[model samples]
Target: MPDTQLTVTLSGEGVGDARVVVRALEQAFGAPDELPSDEKATVHMATFTGEARAEGSPTAPGHLSAPVAVTVQGAPGAVRRASETLARAFTTRDEGAASGDQEQERQLLLEP
Candidate 1:
């Protein structure tokens, strides 16, 4: 099968919280193909190639308690897997009902 590329973007109050989310994503999808960098030092973005797996529960220790927004785009299966992984790490309520196309992309607002 062809590789599936997933892009995850995190934006929130503390960069540490974003970093924690990234670590969780890495555990699910393996190391990111493109790691986040400080372009302007506000938002964090990373990309991974492949379907995600739930290896284990990811924890954030010493991370700031703040709100986080995560966007994941990839194949439908990969997106679903990533969404499930993220839901475990952060408290998320569905932003809106997803349509068929929307299912391929997930947008989650997370709270600590």
Candidate 2:
């Protein structure tokens, strides 16, 4: 299988809001390499491996105190899957995307 590792970065009102986003992703992609944390910074990040599972509880709109800025990066398919999964779970605005020879990145603004 092509590398399906995906990295998700999020910045929200606080760690709690970010966790909500992560939890939604966990449903579709299983657990991440590590959970998101403040790390004394404004953003948190987590990495998920393998293809997104087909069977899982359907993602629903998660509550957020404020909009969350999310960035997904990895193999093109992996990035696309992650982005779509998030959109299904939240009101999202596509910020844009960029592609490299071996990886892709997309940004989204997730609303409450």
Best by lDDT: 2
Candidate 2 ranges beyond 4 A from true positions: 1-3
- Clashes found in each candidate (C-alpha, N, C closer than 3 A): 0, 0
RMSD of each: 2.9, 2.0
User: For this target, which candidate reaches the highest TM-score against the unseen true structure?
Assistant: 2
Q: How many backbone clashes does candidate 2 have?
A: 0
lDDT of 1 by residue, 42-108 (tens): 7888888755564675664334378888888777777777787777766776564244753477788
Off by over 4 Å in 1: 1-4, 50-54, 57-64, 97-103
What is candidate 1's TM-score against the reference?
A: 0.76
Q: lDDT per residue, candidate 2, 1-112, as tens digits?
A: 5356888999978888888888888876778888877546689998888567775667563689899999999988888878878888888899999999999999999998
In terms of lDDT, model 2 sits at: 0.84
lDDT on C-alpha atoms for all candidate structures: 0.72, 0.84
